[model samples]
Target: MLMVALCGAVAGFVLLGHSWLQLLIAGALGIIFTQFAFLAHEAAHRQIFAKGTTNDRYGRILGTAFVGISYSWWMNKHSRHHANPNRVGKDPDIEGEALAFYEEKAVPRTGLRAIIARKQGYLFFPMLILEGLNLHYASVKSLVTRSEKPTKGRFVEIGMLAGRFALYLGAVFWVLPVGMAFAFLGVQLAIFGLYMGASFAPNHKGMPIIPAEVKLDFFSRQVRTSRNIAGRFWPTVLMGGLNYQVEHHLFPSMARPHLARARLLVRQHCQDHDVPYTEVSLASSYGTVVSYLNRVGLAARDPFACPVASQLGRR
Candidate 1:
């Protein structure tokens, strides 16, 4: 993790020095950092090393320095997300102010709110970025106002988050020239924005947002709750193989590089077992999401209210 962070920093410094190289280096390093983010995620789930402690320790270090996130917070929150994905009232994954899934009770039905609700998907990208920051702020607030004693790991996570933020500030204000600093920040922001946008949209959106009343088996839930993108090599590399959303959700322990193979394996298993599986090409899947967003602004509605087996069906 230290080595990866150092390499990223050196690449970033080179990007700062050369104006023309900014975009190339930024894109490259952004991909590197994005991959590191996945590694941190894997570690948080104790999927990286044989020992849970080692996995957590590595996750914390890499998450703080390379990804600028706290692993402990991620683990706690993400566990909840996985446990209750798309459950409107229960899932923390619906932390974004712009809710994407509709619940019968929470439906908005008037004037501007109605308009926003109708076109909710279009605003999802910006909302996602805001929600990421919101999550950080909310976590810190929770930590400070807690009446009960915090755990040692929680304190360590908070401290690491603070340090990472400080380092980011220092890099922007003190380490580099104004222009260079802004460039670096811009690059980081681009990466952050892209990461959130690309990785999230396909997982649950455009799928049936079921009510808690719907009793789904484990395999059914896994298949229904996620979509798979048959992305080619370049896109897979750029997105850190997150395009294989269904496979990742099912086996979060597997490394990103192995997702495609896992997807194939899962597909064959599902076929043999007579289980339903959803797969769409990358372009079509992304297009479905965009079209949905264009139709629904920021309000919670079931994207898969009308399910189409293929992208053409959506059209």
Candidate 2:
């Protein structure tokens, strides 16, 4: 069913050809594809399908088709994120940790590259471009450079990457006229950037950056380490169900369709258990993220300083 929806949407965009209307349609479908990717994420976690090989099979099929990312990569890294949350040096999800905390850092006696790295997260739209590049780079580097032998999962990823390249080439040469192809790619990239930025911005940015040394309890870790955003259906759908990030971090096995219910349950449990639960309207959450980014951008000459090192420097 998900595959059919993605195919129909991609085909619809292809058939429309290169008008402004075609671009609009392609953008809409791109958003739909992003939503499908989220569902694939749920499947990867065995939240959608029965928890077994069936879930793995379905997740790979649906996820790779909608997005170039592999289920293997997501499972390996994303699970680590949930396990460790925001443990500074330990979390794979922490993109250049030091760079993310520029606002609190002291003056740096360092290279010009360091300064740019600190403020890199706030360049906003461009970061999406960097993220796409980072995805490709990381995948390739992992494949070629990993010390361990390639597993079946890695082989599957190789196949998926090849398939993605073929489909992209086919779209360029055979599916549509050159102009229409360019337009399709442009709209798709724009939607991709928007999706990446919006989905991730609220996750951890302004939240207190924990040092590697801090030992936190489970509920305190979750409340302080994660954030939730409030958005209408459009943003939620566009973000592929990630708007309920707090629920996701807690119960990653729940399907996105069930996240709202899960959020209520988690809130109730927190109340009963006396856990410190954090809640913010979606608008305010996103606002907090933006404000943090702006402050980090305007403050330190180098925003990318390692939080631990910077804290020690302050002392």
Candidate 3:
């Protein structure tokens, strides 16, 4: 709450100041929005409240209104991800798009898309510069395309998103020159996207990609597929408890404050069960993700090769 208040105050002051240099505050606001997004994510998981309805209410407000993302869209997609992390054909996170998490997804790529797939690891961070825009676009797209489905708070989210963008864009245009306003918005979105991608990409990207047909117990599925960033204070604060991703996956409803202790318990349990528990430094995890993506990209370079061979190479 204090941070929220501080962010609003600083943003208000900076907007009224009319200084180009104050665009830096826009970058800071991006980081702040990502923090709110994390809170929204937790709320959606029912970690912030006892009742599911209460959590949904707050999740909608924080995600759609404050963070300019659709709670309904995120909830549906993220729930699927939690239910099947890194599982082929099941986990939406690993679904083939611009970047392929699994090798087979890369095999059919051609032309520029193939080029991107081949070097996606190196371009991942740069690609994330558009993630903020992508999130907003995807949220609205989900709502529009899935209108026939019964979505809780669908119209309400649309209204909130409309209002949120109205006020945000209104303020930006009102306070700054047209050119500067665009630049300011660009910086904010870029930073928000980059930070979000950086925090999330390390969690499961380099970890095992489970076959869709393979059935695993909950403990094994969550523990083996997730990787933890080794840290206590700063990582927890910066990543919004995402650094404790292994523990987070095991206990989706676990509150941020308890994740650290949960990590120890989860790690010991994994050790006892002889399950692979991955914990690496933040830097090391990033390198692993990049290397992993590059290896998957190799499939695009050789389209005729056996997919089984590529899968074997991945292991």
What lDDT does each candidate get? 0.65, 0.67, 0.88
What 10-residue stretch in candidate 2 is worst by lDDT? 101-110
Question: Which portions of model 3 miss their true places by more than 4 Å?
Answer: 2-16, 302-315
Q: Which one wins on lDDT?
A: 3
C-alpha displacement of 126 in model 1, angstroms? 4.4
lDDT (C-alpha) at residue 99 in model 1: 47
Query: How high is each candidate's TM-score?
Result: 0.78, 0.80, 0.93
Instruction: Report the lDDT tens digits of candidate 3 across residue range 1-315.
Output: 737764684667465667777577788788889989999999998999999999999888889998999999899899999999999999999994979899889988888888888899999999999999999999998877756678887789889999999988997888788998888899999999999999999999989999978999998899899999988999998899999998898899999999998888887887898989999999999999999999898778755667687569852
Q: Which stretches of candidate 1 lie over 4 Å from their true place?
A: 1-30, 103-106, 109-113, 126-132, 135-139, 145-152, 177-187, 272-274, 293-315
RMSD of 3: 3.8
lDDT of 1: 0.65
Give per-candidate clash totals.
11, 7, 0
Q: After TM-score superposition, what is the CA distance of residue 26 in candidate 2 from its true location, in Å?
A: 3.5
Query: What TM-score would you give candidate 3 relative to the actual structure?
Result: 0.93
Residue-pair clashes, model 3? 0
Strongest candidate by TM-score: 3
